[model samples]
Target: MGAEYGQEGLVSTSCDIYSFGIMMMEVFTSKKPTDEMFTSDLSLSHWVSKALVNGVTQAMDSRLIRKDEENFFAEVNCVSSIFELALNCTAESPENRINIKDALAFLQKIRLEFLVKLSEN
Candidate 1:
C-alpha cells in the first residue's frame, strides 16, 4: 500500500508503485518504516528526503557508502538518481507519480550514466 491507502483506503496499481518505491528506499537506506527514529510523522521517506538535502551519502546505508572506493562518488550519484525516482513514485498523489514506463526509462538512463561514469575512472 501507499499514501493512497491513507487517503482512499484502497489498494491499487498506483499503490503498488508506491510500495515499490518504498521498498527501493528501504533497500538503499537500510531503514525500516517503523524504525525508532521514524516516529511522530518522520517516516522513512521523509527522513531520507531531509538527509538528502545534505548529500546522498547521508541518505544511503553506511555499508553502501564506500567513501574510500575509487567509484564512490559515481556510486553515490547513481543511488541519488534512483532515490529521485523513488520520490517521484511515492508522491502523495498517485496521479502525480511517474508512470511505470517512465520510471523504467529513467532507471535505464541512470544505469547507463553510472556505467559511463564508471568507465571514466
Candidate 2:
C-alpha cells in the first residue's frame, strides 16, 4: 500500500506504482525501506534524493559502478533517471503519481539513451 492508501484508505493502481517505485529504489540503492537508517524524516526515497544531489555514484549500488567503469557516465545517467521516476511514482498524492504506461515509456527511453551512450564509448 502507498501513502495515499494508508492515509486515505483508498485502493487504486497508484498504490501499485508506489510499490514499484520503492522496489526500484531498493534495487538501485541496495537499501530496503525498513533499513535502520530510515526514519520518519529520512526515508529510503529521501536518502536517494539527497544522495543524487551530490552524484548518482553516491546513491547507486557500488557493484554497478565497479562493474561498468568504462560506461560510468551512461550508468549514472540511467540510474538518476530511474530514481527520478521512482520519486514521481511515489508522490504523496495518488493523482500526482505517474501511470504504468508513462512509466514504461520513460524507462524505455532511458534504456535507449543508455544503450546509445554505451555504444559511443
Candidate 3:
C-alpha cells in the first residue's frame, strides 16, 4: 500500500528525520503543519524562513507577546537558530538533510547554551 520512491523505495529512517524536523519547527513556532496552511507552496517552513530573514518578532505568534517583555528579542534570536536547523533537516533532498539523531544532538547543544546564558543572568 506504500508508494515507491526509487530503487530503495521507502525508508522509515528518512521519514523519521523529516518528522523530527517538522516537530521541532512546531515546538518553536507553536504552529500546526497541516497542508491547508501551506497551500500554494507556502508552508510553515517557508513562513518561518521568511520571518527569520525579516525579523524574529514578525515570526512569533502575537498571542505569546507580553505587555512588558524584556528578553523577547533575545529569545527570538535563540529560536531563530533552532529554526534554521529544522529547515536544514527538512531540506528538499534527503541527501541534503541531517538525520534525527544529529538534529537531536544539535538541539541539545542549543539548549545547553541557552541554559548557561540563563544561569549567567
TM-score of each: 0.93, 0.93, 0.76
Tens-place lDDT per residue, model 3, 6-116, is 545776666666677778777766787774677767887788889888986676666665536666555665787788888877776677788777887888887887777
- Determine which window of 10 residues in candidate 1 has minimal summed lDDT: 47-56
What is the C-alpha local distance difference test score of each model? 0.87, 0.90, 0.71
Better of 1 and 3 by lDDT: 1
Worst 10 residues of 3 by lDDT: 1-10
Clashing pairs in 2: none
Clashing residue pairs found in predicted model 1 = none
Candidate 1 lDDT by residue in tens digits, 1-120: 686688779888889888889989999999878889888878888877876788877879999867789998999999999888988888888898888899899999999999999999
lDDT value for model 3 = 0.71
lDDT of 2 by residue, 7-106 (tens): 8798889999999999999999999999998898899988888877987778788977775478877888899999999998988788999999999999
